[model samples]
Target: MNAPTAVTRSQTADAVTVILFGAAALVVTAISTVLRILGTFRDQGIAWSIPIDEQPIDATVDSGAASVEGIAQEAMVFAAGVDPVSTAAIIGSLALWALAPLIVIVCVMVVAWNLLRGRFFVRGNARAFDAIGWTLVLAPVLIVLLENVGLNGVTAAMGLETEGPVHPIEFWSIVPLFATGVAVGLIAAAFRQGIRLQRENAVLEHDTRGLV
Candidate 1:
């Protein structure tokens, strides 16, 4: 029994260590992206990368042996030479990509660290999970709103002849955003239940001493 329990603990520690290492690497990458956002201003004209799949642009690329995931992942709207992208669009796009995920990851790491130390059923842990869920759901709303405003700036700056305004967010995106939010919310709900039970058990033990 002792041997098995020890083995389980050792494995869990190793897994958590690996997770922390990977999370650190991601945090570093996100910081690098933020730094690149600063570098964008030094350019003669701002270079913005919009997904080819998202934009209705006539473009193609020869992906000979390289395998790319998602539709038109390798293709991007190379409009830097045409006109400069807006400051709001530039910052909004990077923030939407970098800051939103960064916030969620930091919250998860804090909760995970506490759970490993057998300090899981606390109000703080529940709030952290709650934050994770809401951040996943609402961060996009604010960031994307800013990004859309920036995109419109690009449209007007370029003087493009369009039948109507551009649609930044599409129907397909709503599915993943909704699904992810719900999954995180369920985890938060579980944590809240754990905290409630822990508090109730503590009260019962104190009131009815030696009975619990």
Candidate 2:
């Protein structure tokens, strides 16, 4: 295919990627939040942290004492703890977390747009590449960190405690998560290289056309 046609297709694909990924992220996030809300209504109490080498048991929850009304009341209490300032911060962070894939998609879209627009061969995508790399590398880390902090905060605030020895998911799970993050970062770096090569080829082709 001709360069112009290829570029057009590239742009179209990028636009579609942005739209589909963004929409999916929003939908998934909403579904996840809804599921979490429903889960909170279960008879079991939410476990915060796990101790080493022990199976987690139901601690602070009493199914007999739990009621739909009580669940609603507890939700109100939880919401109250999230004051406006904290609420905004939490919302913003959660938005970012839920939209993490969208962020990467947007970055990729921006890089493609820049290439079509004939921006800097090297520098045009520096920021976009950097964003992509860092987003991939830090997304999981930030999520884990935020989740731990949030869990601890809520547990302390609500005086939540597990009765039995709680052994959270083994540290092995976290290792894979971190490894996946690193793998994504590596892929982003590879994409950055490809973008750089594309930019250089575009420049070279332009020069050849000028000479022709």
Candidate 3:
């Protein structure tokens, strides 16, 4: 049996790495955006309230006869309202929201920069590959972030709550941060892999040319 070629291993590693990084970047952007929005709402003073059972009382007439009384009350109540905003925090949050798109753009720019810098699996077409890679990564992150933010605001305003240990708003806020981290790692891996594959291909091409 023939030995495994360096080119094959390099290509495989590069492809896998690129895939992982790209996917991770996408996921992180999505998750973080969502979580941030939810957190904002939670911070705004929206909350759930469970009703306390009213105790029964007996009323006695002059004759000493007791009459039972019953009253119905809501089992649960949800209080939704905007939190008092500090000038600094409000400004900061607004700035953060405004700059979110920029963050996504930067991530994409990095990918593009890497590709154009001859860091990806492109032969002679280095510039084009970089541009394409950057675009692919940029679009999704922006869309997901924006959507999550909008959804979070709407949900909070509507005063929706679920009966469980975790609140939907809270879950959305925290879970996305974790997801975003995973995504960042994945995208990084993809970039690394792309670089590796590009190098491997170069060497293989050289070898093949020499043999011919």
Candidate 4:
């Protein structure tokens, strides 16, 4: 029996890549959409007690007996209660959350589709890598920005003053995300070199066949 040709092997690999990436994308998108819907309902004052963590604080300033330690260690419990966020803010937040996973899914599919084309073209691959890398990198940044912006807007709208810093960045968690993005960008450079070498070898093989 004849073994598979180089073209056949490439096609098989491409198909596997497409299936794996595509399936992952579909699953993540579905989960994100569902969670977003549920979150919107909770924000609108549905059953949200599953994640409640309440703290008590005493404000004795008006009694002329304010203590520095007590005031500094005070824990504020800011609740939306039955008051819903503005329709615009709710929609915007959900849109941003939904867009994050969608962007990732699209980038993964783009890379898989390019592989299926069987050309190993450097430009297309580079674009895909750049997109994925930047998306991963900027995802955390966008989240932070959106959180702070949304928090300030909603609080102001509700005539509330935040006790401490609003939407503080969790640097420990974000470090890994930024690192992964940079790693992907570096991997794209490596792929560019590999694609160039592959193309040159293909060219040489064609020339040899013609000469023979």
Candidate 4 ranges with C-alpha deviation above 4 Å? 1-14, 17-21, 27-31, 34-38, 41-93, 163-169, 197-212
The better-scoring model by TM-score among 3 and 4 is 4
Q: How accurate is candidate 3 locally (lDDT)?
A: 0.47
Query: Model 4: which ten-residue window has the lowest total lDDT?
Result: 44-53
What is the per-residue lDDT of model 1 for residues 1-212, given as tens digits with 9 covering 90 to 100?
Answer: 00111235874686598568759867786778867776554445554444333433343347555534443443323234333345655676676667666767777777766655556677667787777788778776665665555555544455643223435545346557767887888988897887778778777777888664
Clashing pairs in 2: 59-163
Q: Candidate 3, which segments miss by more than 4 Å at Cα?
A: 1-86, 105-172
Give candidate 1's error at residue 190 in angstroms.
Answer: 2.4
lDDT of 4 by residue, 1-212 (tens): 11123346767686677768777777877888788667555534422211123444445565766633232332222335323444344455566667766766676677666555554555666777877788779876766554455455444544666323433444556788889999989978887877777778888888999999
What's the CA RMSD for each of the models?
Answer: 6.3, 8.8, 15.5, 9.7
How many clashes (backbone atoms < 3 Å, residues ≥3 apart in a chain or on different chains) does model 4 have? 0
Candidate 1 deviant stretches above 4 angstroms: 1-15, 35-42, 49-86, 162-171, 210-212
> What does candidate 3's lDDT look like per residue over 108-161, in tens digits?
545444443434443223333333444345433543453344334434445543
Clashing pairs in 4: none
- Give the least accurate 10-residue stretch of model 3, judged by summed lDDT: 82-91
- lDDT computed for candidate 2: 0.53
Between prediction 1 and prediction 4, which has the larger TM-score? 1
Candidate 2 local lDDT, 145-183, one digit each (tens): 554554444444465542332225533455665566566
Best by lDDT: 1
